[model samples]
Target: MKHALIFRVVLGLILSSCLSSCGMAFRSEWKKAPVTSGVEGKWQGTWLSDENGHHGELRCVVAAPISRKLAVQKFFYHATWKTILSGSYEAMHTVQKQKDGTYTFKGEHKMPDWAGGLYHYEGTIKGDEFKANYKCAMDHGTYVMKRVR
Candidate 1:
């Protein structure tokens, strides 16, 4: 009886120690941080190739009233038109920021069908700018943005 009692106590101690040291919690945030009032202004910057072969500029502004579900972005892009079939152009989209610091924005070009399907976005914030980035699966290109104001 004493051997059984001693075995049970030792087993309990070992299990308790292991659980206490595990210290693991569940974390689920889409992004990383929050936006400040000053960083919430228009951002104007360029998109250049890492190889210096191509470049374009973007001018974007956030509004006074930011909705919980949507923000706005306007883009004027000028590409070589090899496959684009056009020259310089203007476009718009509504963006959303998740509490976890992740963001989502959809362009308006494909409205009822795509609804910004091409622009589901993600970005990070630097010193004075919201460094937004979006990935293009078709072109295999990534856009980097900085806050202008």
Candidate 2:
């Protein structure tokens, strides 16, 4: 039993290391991605949980839409908790440009039931400000970011 527990711990560490390395590689690629007039760019900000008041640092890389007709933007996010634990995920949201010069977006991402099941996001981007509210079975929160220039 002791040997089995040790093996599991070691395996978990290896998997965590691999995932962290992948995130680092993606961050480098995001830095090289071009900035456009749309929401595509590097973003830095914080995520606040309205339910629990837990907040942390957040960073996102928004990829430009493949076509104007589709209007789907990919958001790659890295979030930290309590200054220690962290995770990364990708979400795609359909963006609609409004007459008032702001863009509204909504999307859903599926996560494990233990985590959140299905998470929904609704947000708006105006100029350099990106604000979004997220909801799920486990927690609901808001993301506030500014385009990195």
> Using lDDT as the measure, which candidate wins?
2
- Tens-digit lDDT track for model 2 on 47-92? 9989768789998888888567989888888877667666677888
**Span of 10 residues, lowest total lDDT, candidate 2:** 5-14
What does the lDDT read for residue 105 in candidate 1?
52
Per-candidate Cα lDDT values, in order, are: 0.41, 0.80
Q: Give residue 126's error in model 2 in angstroms.
A: 0.3
Candidate 2 has which clashing residue pairs, if any?
A: none
lDDT of 1 by residue, 33-63 (tens): 2244433454556554333234455444444
Using TM-score as the measure, the top candidate is: 2
